[model samples]
Target: MAESQDELSYSLKREAEKKGFQPVGIARITKSKRIKLRTDALERWIEAGHHADMNWMKAPARIEAEKLLYGVKSVLVVGLNYFTIPENKKPNQLLIGRYAQGNDYHKVIEKRLKEIGKWLQTKRPDSKWKICVDSKPLLEKAWAEEAGLGWIGKNSNLINSKQGSWMVLGNLLSTEELIPDKPSESLCGKCQKCIEACPTKAIVEPFVIDSRKCIAYHNIENRNKDIPIEIQKAMGLWIAGCDICQEICPWNQQKIPISLDPDTQPKEWILDLTAKQAKEWDDKNWQKKLKGSSLKRIKPWMWRRNANYILKNNKFNSSK
Candidate 1:
């Protein structure tokens, strides 16, 4: 007879895959021991000053992650593809990572997770469940790596041999026990493209990134009145997020592209806006052009700041 637990887990994975999540895996939250180790790593990483200006990276609130899956016997992880087929869209003309070009990923992932949770309830009526996306302090990438969906790469982003790190990850921790999957081994091998491609050299060393110097960190997290002059010239007009590391990663070349939810696709105006045109953009037009999009993080003023920065820096190349 097929084990009831195994059957239910298989069903859960199938449901998630049908919903267009590229990869799905199950693992137990019975990993309290790993929690302590992660905390140690977190403390050490912070002490080494790699986290940079993101003070929240060292927040005490992360203690909850130690027990995020407590009383839960399984975690169902889902990975969704978010890549756009176009290569290097209007480069140096101001860019946001494909992930941030659409609606906020937290909302997108949570919508699908709720459906999975409801389906689980139908299957395991007595079980309790909690869901989370990147919004939480949980060591989600570590858990995903342990669940066999992928390996943690040298750039500190998770990688699947077939698909790369351009996907969003989500998980549901449940009281229902399920068959657990094994962890994946590193597939980065000797590759270091992501490290060499970083404009800010944020990947200070293998598997270690210095967030303070990262372009993504600056464009998204920083509200400083004056960005570091050197960094400002190098910002290259990235208003929201950066994808240089992932773009240079070899794995992105291996996979067949997948369909994305239409509503989450970027508007045409995103690529059409130029450094010169963006400076004249009004708030109302921006609101409509970027409706429901993640660029809302780069508020009108911030986007203008980025556009102006790009215009100023690119002026040196006008003769070309």
Candidate 2:
């Protein structure tokens, strides 16, 4: 007997849970007025130079779903929780965001999405499909909200009631028509902790962020070694990515520390690195050190520059 759309959606959710994608939801594709408004807002933000050097945000991949996939009827939104609050900071240690501590999530999530796509193909052989991770320009958070995965929080992150904001999102677009889930509502209300917590004041408005002042943007996206004096000073000891906003969110407080997978924790040497080792660090050593890590996106010189900034800010000398 041919299974109903509800059955297929339930089956897909089961498989996604088996694959470790918690809070998965399916959304039907439609021409959205809200998306159009967001596109206009994005254009204005770009014009205001809020995007910094990431001009790719204006690319076709950022276009609407109907444009990205013809006859696209459904979007499978999946959330993977990568939230692990670090233990107390040790003396002279650099801070790396939890998201970048593991194998490149782009690789990990996309691999799983592909597996789900294959499963869908087996069930509906005639259906066309498209898979997207952070690498793709799709506005995944909006889709996630539409799919009832979570609400877009004041920190400009998708926040699930159960998972909080410590999530990485991936999407699967398919030609098959499936039942759509109800959209999650805005739960931010009057809370403004994330806004006040930012050292660089990157969150300009309730749900908007100016990347020019974002620590993560400067550390990861800024190709130039010469970061602005104010941003550098505000950067503190973050050598890779920043997590201040997410850390300050009330929702994230509920996150219990999960087991630390070997691949997901910073290398031992990284935690105990001294000024002497940092000064002697070179490109060859940097490549070998971050071989499987996502930090490789930034070149060796950038890493050195960030480390030097931190060392200089803290006035760390070679001794001890």
Weakest 10 consecutive residues, lDDT, candidate 2?
255-264
State which candidate has the highest TM-score: 2
- Residues 1-320, candidate 1, lDDT per residue (tens digit)? 43399788888899998887877898776545654665677788899988877666765646453366556777888887787667455644567677876677788888888998999898777778888787676677777876789987878888887777878889888988789888777888899999988888888888788878888777777787556666777777676678888878888777746546664576677766677667778888777776777667667766777766777787534321
Q: In model 1, where do residues sit more than 4 Å from their true spots?
A: 1-3, 32-38, 59-70, 87-92, 316-320
Model 2 clashing residue pairs (backbone) = none
**CA lDDT, candidate 2, residue 72:** 90
TM-score of each: 0.89, 0.93
Q: What are the per-model C-alpha RMSD values against the true structure?
A: 2.9, 2.0
- For candidate 2, lDDT tens digit of each residue in 53-150? 89888776676776677889999999877755466666777777778777777887888889999999889988888898887888888889889999
Task: Report lDDT per candidate.
Answer: 0.76, 0.81
Give RMSD (Å) of candidate 2 vs. truth. 2.0
lDDT, candidate 1, at 134? 78
